[model samples]
Target: MAVSNVYYTNMRTTLQENLLQKLERLVRKAGMMDMDFENKFTAIKIHFGEPGNLAYLRPNYSKVLVDLIRSKGGRPFLTDCNTLYVGRRKNALDHLDAAYENGYNPFCTGCHMIIADGLKGTDEVLVPIDGEYVKEAKIGRALMDADIVISLTHFKGHESTGFGGALKNLGMGGGSRAGKMEMHNAGKPFVNQELCVGCGSCKKNCAHGAITIEDRKASIDVNKCVGCGRCIGACPVDAVDSMCDEANDILNKKIAEYTWAVLKDRPHFHVSLVVDVSPNCDCHSENDAAIVPNVGIFASFDPVALDMACVDAVNRQPVINGSYLAEQEHCHHDHFKDTHPDTNWETCIDHGVKLGLGNREYNLITI
Candidate 1:
């Protein structure tokens, strides 16, 4: 059966009048509220931007969605798994602090924040998937256990994936920290001898004892490395970095497969806010300049269709001067591909379609 995607940009009057009101209308138009929600737990997968990142989706938008879910007799909670790289969100304690600091408090979004991977980032469910890159996907237990899943993605450019849309949000954002490592890298983390200051910070911070220093430089024992990503953040000089040996196409296909694991059997809905329009993901503590002006909010039953529609919409918009994409002559092409020449965002959508996750073809209706 073919899936349908519904879209609505952010052109309404106000948050009270425009954004919030539009969310209600979009949910209805997408028929998301048509599902049975009485006394059921609905997990709203979202990225609570890392601390110092100011480009995250506004808490106001979450309130709109949360209110709508509640009105349908569903209990909704904002949730995200721990990140692969060490930061404010590598563990549940710090992760929750980062979330609350970013104004994801219940008072602000009208929903509690839950770290899906648990305190140590080990509470996970291993889902078997036959894919080129991944055999089993490590997903957060709470998300895997949810009655329904909703992804509220902040659509933007990504240095790795061309763009972080619904697929990236579900595949990368939904994984356990270890799961993210599996999807992002071909192997474990490595240390740059030049950047190591012999600070011992990496070793001390490493919970797995995967790192060791010799002659004031750090080295990673892949055998011992758990791929936890803590040493990556501990290096002051940015010496430790992710291994990019994973093929981009394989990454995209694996992402689709992982997303399938996350939402295959559950009632799933996706929404994306195309504001900020940063040239990189909100995962960065510092967001780069917007490559394009704010597009709008989008909602759909099919994540792939929604993402494809968003890329098309951005490509149609006039490129902003002085942005990262301004100098590119082919800015008229797929906006994400134009910005990231090596990445193919369509791979995710196509693979999603293949995985029975969603459809790539969509009907865009302006609201």
Candidate 2:
């Protein structure tokens, strides 16, 4: 396979040129402007950082892309799907609040923020891509409707995937509530009985008739439940929950397949910043100390190659003393592995390569 070009620029900045300016320069050098953006609806997929998580990329970073896109006559919007877990971002209203609280509002990003999956997490588009795992990916309706897709990722370690990079930001982040369930579990959800109010909201929303209200309690019939995750959103008390029982390796593969479904027929670009380098995902309410020193920013049309390059850059750094990585036993000789021993981040990349997402071999072009 041929090697893709991954552009890089160190975090160093001069008095005249700040980090944001450097980022603009890097993306332009990486060929972000090569695509025809005239009148296109560009979806900039990003994590607004779960409320209280301080490690996600700031809205200032996103404004760079928003401004650039608008300059090219493209309509840009920052978007992300509702989370499967019960959090501040579980619904559109709360999700918008979390985003604005994190400074991702229109005033900051120079574009509107959209909760891709609608008021409930049930609004989705079925994208069929025959992969080994996912046959039809349930992606956010707004995300699939965009003319272009761009991922603005914050590179960090993850308990499940070892590291969260471009592909994780695109695949896992792009999934609707049900899409996330399919990737993380066996396509089934269970009710949290303690939290169930038996309001019949879930029962009313379940198209499969899998939910039953028994003695003022809600229970899901797994046999009949199609795992569309509609009930999860409809439950006012947040009683519905995903099983999340899929094996780690399988989960990674499903994420890659979902990524293919998102980017298959759209013009896409990926940009990842290896800053903060948190020990766990930004999905966490709290972010740990950095595991390693800041690497830099990387961009490419090829997400697989972009991720590969970022991982390589991160592995080359010295572990930060007193950080999570420093506290762990360094048996893997890899920072991400040593940080999250149970995870094998390679599965996603290898599966992405097999899916023809991008080449694993990349030619790093430092600017």
Model 1: pairs clashing at backbone N, Cα or C within 3 Å: 10-296, 14-18
Which candidate's lDDT is highest? Answer: 2
Native-to-model Cα distance after best TM-score fit, residue 88 in candidate 1, in Å = 2.3
Runs in model 1 with CA error above 4 Å?
14-16, 191-220, 223-241
Q: Candidate 2: lDDT of 320?
A: 95
Model 2 off-target regions past 4 Å? Answer: none
The sequence of per-residue lDDT tens digits that candidate 1 reaches over residues 1-367 is 5547567756547645766787778777877888888878999999999889999987888888888889889999999987766578877888999998998899999989999988766678999887656788989998988899999999899877889999999888888766777787764878878767888988998887788788888898999887766676556666877775787887888888889889887888899888888888888899877889888888898888898888877877877889888866584367787888888877888888878887777888776
Q: Would you give me the overall lDDT of model 2?
A: 0.93
1-367: candidate 2 lDDT, tens digit per residue: 7889999999999999999999999999999998889999999999999988999998999999999999999999999999999899999999999998998889889999999999988889999999999999999999999999999999999999999998998899899999999999988989888888889999998888888899999998999999998888888887888999999999999999999999998899999999999999999999999999999999999999999999999999999999989999998889989999999999999999999999889999998
As a TM-score, model 1 comes out at 0.88
- Report the lDDT of model 1 for residue 185: 76
